[model samples]
Target: MSFSSILGYFLGGYFALVISLFMLSSVVPVAGFAARTLSAYISIVICATYGVLASIFLRIVGREQIAQWTTARAFKYVMAITIGITFEVDDPKRHLDTVRPAVFIGNHQSELDVLMLGCIFPKYCSVTAKKALKYVPFLGWFMALSGTIFIDRKNSKDARQAMAGAAKEIQTRKQSVYIFPEGTRSYAKDPGLLPFKKGAFHLAVQAGVPIVPVVAANYSHVLYIKDYIFRSGKIPVKVLDPIPTTGLKPEDVDELTRSTRELMLKEIVALTQKVQNRPIAIPATSGDGVVHASGADATLS
Candidate 1:
């Protein structure tokens, strides 16, 4: 509702138009799939270049100003992408001060979760992604530069190792890591977290970090992974209070995961109720942005 948000929305709309045009030109068969792929690659390179330049400018000019702008840009891009797909998304984060260097577990409902979450967090945060995304043109490069952690989902051992490495990064780098515990997007309401896989939680416990649970609704209805088109509707995202791990050990991973999963399910139920009854406001930001000097932070306490 502020002037800045409105301005950001407009700026993002322009960027979205450009990207969409490139997407179409590269896809339309006159050039062939290979050519389209190549075109997409070129377009991605340009976008990556822009991202790098912006990052540099922000770092050099004023770190705080850039952080603020990046925050707004994240919102703008998510809003633009939502608009591009004719859908809407809401973002909310709770216990943000205790959020840094913690594992972020979100309800997996659609493919758009990556973009939505990326926009919500600061740039240093990473998403533990599948290896397939590495093949994406601009996305892959951006991921590389942005320090995204990718795992080879096909190879169990490799995936486990990648998860371990990602956990290490979260601990050592003191960065936020996002993962979808369900392993895949769900099509049903209150799908109940698809059972928290041990990978994400194991990493959290290993890193001695808290788990910040997020509940997202109406994303699947807006855009399904099977297709890339956009749809418009209110997609509410809620970040719940984080589960602390002050005295936690790896042995408690299962209990932590289970409790967080149950709590997230409850949040989903509440979000569903809000959707059915009245408007819900997803907070633009939450948590205090703090990082401990020693990597072993029990900040959530």
Candidate 2:
């Protein structure tokens, strides 16, 4: 690593320690949360200012480096550092080659999935998110600048159009798209897996690409979606083999989604068993095609 790279890593590590210390303190949880949020807001401003300036600098100082694949790799690490510190992540490794430009499907158990994955996969990819993320001051602006695709989930027609737009962007532009098939996070320990949302599979079919199933193990063990029982433990990110949809039809979207969900569930169960060092029963999926606490099987008809 160059001097600049070393500096970036040190800064990134310090930032993570400071941020985690500020937020996880019991003396002032509210203050800590507010501080973290404020820091995120500030970081967005700093990153925007510096990132744009860096791009411009690259344009001026060394056009070759800016255009070089090496610089892009550096930027990915920088972004990954920012994400790791911000989310208090531990031992993040990309188990798959994200260079091929494919759709990523993962189990959603917390709000940190996007931030965590965005940091890990720093390629020119897009995420299918709700319209709300597009309105946030800093996050919204940054995501837009990063070419994220926003979908209006409230209106079915708008959602379809958004999905179509995303598909076109992926197929034509070769941009990877990340989507949480669960459509939401689960709070239960044995939440298993949520029903796969058809949108992700549809995108894969429309784009004629494979879907990379990513299993974020033990995310809930750290900081759950609905609680503050923060545990200092390693969250493993396992990027499984990509499920090909080369010869799939739009009508096969449901099957594709279900198959991916089942595969991810199996992976998560395996990981949790190893990490927690005990055998635990995973909840069965619901009738709506999502994993539920009641263990009801949800079939997509």
- Pick by TM-score: which candidate is best? 2
**Root-mean-square deviation of candidate 1:** 12.0
Measured against the true structure, the TM-scores of the candidates, in listed sequence, are 0.59, 0.66
lDDT of 1 by residue, 1-301 (tens): 9999997897677556545655564555322323323333443344446666665555566442233225334544544543443223343443544467787777777545544554455444566666677779866655554556655444444223445656666777677777777666666433344555656776777677877777775544455434443344556667776777777765666577666766777677667656656443432212221212212112111
**Model 2 weakest lDDT span, ten residues long:** 292-301
lDDT of 2 at 155: 38
TM-score of 2: 0.66
**Superposed model 2: Cα runs more than 4 Å off:** 1-95, 129-141, 150-162, 225-227, 288-301
How much lDDT does candidate 2 score? Answer: 0.58
Error of 2 at 290 (Å): 5.8
- Tens digits of per-residue lDDT for model 2, 49-107: 66544445554664322222223344334444443332332333453444467887677
TM-score of decoy 1: 0.59
